[model samples]
Target: MTAKKIGVAILFIVGAGVAYAETPSSLITGYTAEAARATPGFAPSAERGQSLFMRKWGVSKTMPSCATCHSDQPTAEGKHVVTSKRIAPLSPAVNPKRFTNLAKVEKWFGRNCKEVVGRECSAAEKADFIQFVSKGSQI
Candidate 1:
């Protein structure tokens, strides 16, 4: 093949690999790294994530906590408290697509954290949350 064709083929292969490389564990690693940079010795904690999930911030009367819409059990379906829209389980074990996309994860966390936590969630919080839900809420 010509050099141009070989370069294009290599780009396609690399791009495809990158597109499919995201996973829950990878996301946790990324967030934990980010969190650690901010707070030395930081590690993702499922317990902290659960607390964040179940805690009632009372910031939004309609949506006080992550569980308000995600349900206490990450594996179970939930409905929007206001819109009444049905929501799928948050656990990657139950919903394999939950955190495989960093963009989608960021979008949801950005919106949900503001609505429930009253601010954008920190990297540590995101890491903790991904760690918790990736375990299917057994913790």
Candidate 2:
């Protein structure tokens, strides 16, 4: 095959791979279900979750606030250009599948907290965080 033709073929393969990536909605839904059951007091605090979402953690080099990427509303979605995925909304009211399990919740919190907060959130932080996010919704 010609060089130009080879390049085009490679591009097509890459594009197809991108198209097959999982949607953020499904990922977040899975994550939420796991969190609700795994983390204790996951259903209590909308206010604290709101604060955590808006607050920037880390003492010296401040990490970006969750709102920086996620917006002020927990149930709202946001885009991550690097990941090529839209962040799923957090509220049960907005997402019918929000809370179902604990494993998925811990998994996402472990991953996302490190990505956004620059550290793995503590158990207390996770609880407060879940409470903060699950707040105001009928869970």
Candidate 3:
């Protein structure tokens, strides 16, 4: 292959690899920045995230709070309230793959937040949630 072709291939490989691998801190930073745009100087709070996680909204009788399905301990495995399917731990400390994919993170939040919180979670909430799970009670 020509040098130009090799350079293009290298860039494509590197870019594709970076695209899917996300850290909990990076995800929190992105969401925090997005939230700051609307609420100036806003920062993610693990406390708030924990509150959201443990609060029972009664929106879904089967899955009211995130903890209802994820368990009170973020690092512990859980089971789906209705389906009874096994769920992996939510904390990155116990499950390094938890927040590695931005797409999967967003997909679960989109589905779970509406079902539990009764509305879509804000960017701040997302950041806060990641902050909470990433720290796993460290606050």
Candidate 4:
């Protein structure tokens, strides 16, 4: 192939890769950075994230924890126990739309954390939570 043609092919391949490269974990970098401001050298852990997702906080008798809506399996569809509203899968692996928007994500976290955890989720918890969801809680 000519050098010019090869360069064009490479660009096309790279562009295609980027177009399909969105992952839930990519959102964690910003959360991790924010977490570092409060807890220096913060690193998200799947275990912590899983715990956060699964554990019942009992903040609301209606919505005990994230699992109360998201389910133990991040990939599985769930419904709101009280409202009966259907909830999409949480894992980015299975749900391409899981974390594509920053504003919407933050809005949900802010609302849900207060309703479930009884407080706003910190940067660390948010990172861990996203990390856990990104991994589909496989660990």
Q: Please say which candidate is ahead in lDDT: 1 or 2.
A: 1
List, residue by residue over 1-139, the lDDT tens digit for candidate 3.
4343243234324545544567888778777767787899999999999988999998998888999889888888999989899999999998998987666877788789989999878889988998998886535
Candidate 2 residues 5-116, lDDT tens each?
2432343344345444322333333334435555743443446556667777653243367666565776777666456578777765576556444445556776778877
* Model 1 lDDT on a 0 to 1 scale: 0.82
Q: Please give the ranking of all candidate structures by TM-score, highest first, separated by commas.
A: 1, 3, 4, 2
lDDT of 1 at 52: 90
Query: Clashing residue pairs, candidate 4?
Result: none
Give the per-residue lDDT of model 1 (tens digit) for 1-139: 4343243234334535544647888778777876787799998999998999999998999999999998999999999999999999999998998887766777898889999999888878988998999889758
**Against the true structure, candidate 4 has what lDDT?**
0.77
TM-score: the better of candidates 1 and 4: 1
Cα lDDT of candidate 3 equals 0.80
TM-scores for every candidate against the unseen true structure: 0.86, 0.55, 0.84, 0.81
Error of 1 at 80 (Å): 0.4
Model 4 — TM-score against the truth? 0.81
lDDT of each residue in 40-117, candidate 4, tens digit only: 989998899898888889788888989888778998999999889999998888888998766567679878998999
Query: lDDT per prediction?
Result: 0.82, 0.54, 0.80, 0.77
